[model samples]
Target: MLQTLDIEHRLKSTLDEFVADWGLDAEITAETWLVEDLGFDSIDVIQFIVAVETAFDKRNVGFQELIMQDGRYVDDLSVGQMATFLEARLPAA
Candidate 1:
């Protein structure tokens, strides 16, 4: 697996790629709200979901784990939290 610190870099790169793909300049930080802060609607979320799935070749696990009631956690996932999730779930290096 990637080093824990490296995960943040990876997340930033992934977010950068996603933004570039979508022609968006909205900054995505660990604290950025995907909806309120970034203005990501359902289609944007779905596109980001697809990008994340493709990043790890892990299908759509993020969305899969989120039911309708997941609420803010879905948009408020921090870099650290995403790192933890990816470390546990992604294939070992």
Candidate 2:
């Protein structure tokens, strides 16, 4: 099974690729927020979701559960939060 730190590192690398494609210069860290720190809008967030799913080769991992709360979309998400969520869903490596 992959360790938590391994998951985080891979996730961060995926995020770095996404940021580069978007031409953003900000550094991605565990504490970096998608909306607040990266200034991602709704479309950007959707694109980011696609990037993450493609990176992990997961399309039905229930990302809605992580992005939604109380039947509403979340305001923001941190890189660490995303890594934790993916870690739970990804198969053993």
Candidate 3:
């Protein structure tokens, strides 16, 4: 089974590649905000969520529940939070 730490590491790596490929001008960390800190608008956020789903090789994973509120992303949504969310969704192996 993949440990929690392993999942987090993979999540971080995936996010790193996402940021690089998109040419985002912000540092990605556990506490980095996707919309505010990373400069991701609504469309970018959707694209990023798709990229993360692909990166983790998981489908139908919903991140909007975690990041969205009142039709907008919550300001405090962080990379670490997303990692934690993914860790729960990904099957252990």
Candidate 4:
């Protein structure tokens, strides 16, 4: 298991790099919105995923897995959530 600090750092780093590639500006604590803040739809999601995959060199990740909107959630989340998900799923070398 990854330490909480390590996980958060990795997540934030990935998010920052990805956002930069898209010419988006966001703080580490910024909450990334899907359709509103980031203006991202399905295609954008794929693009972001691909970007992240390359940056982290992780395998292709699915959309549904990162769209964690339940348990009092509804339909969306910030990029942090996605990063956290990816960090957890990273394959151990």
TM-score of each: 0.64, 0.89, 0.75, 0.58
**Candidate 1 lDDT, 21-81, residue by residue in tens:** 6666677666555666656777776776677767767774645455234444354444455
lDDT of each: 0.63, 0.85, 0.75, 0.61
What is candidate 3's lDDT per residue for 20-41, written digit by digit as tens? 8666667667778777787777
Write the residue-wise lDDT of candidate 2 on 33-67 in tens digits.
Answer: 99998888988888888988888777987888999
Residue 26 lDDT, candidate 1, scale 0-100: 72
Candidate number with the higher lDDT (3 or 4): 3
User: Which prediction has more favorable TM-score, 2 or 3?
Assistant: 2
In angstroms, the error of model 2 at 29 is 0.9
lDDT-based ranking = 2, 3, 1, 4
How far does residue 67 in candidate 1 sit from its true spot (Å)?
A: 5.4
* Steric clashes per prediction: 1, 0, 0, 0
At residue 83, give the lDDT of candidate 3: 75
Query: Highest TM-score among the candidates is held by which one?
Result: 2
Candidate 1 residue pairs in backbone clash: 1-93
lDDT of 2: 0.85
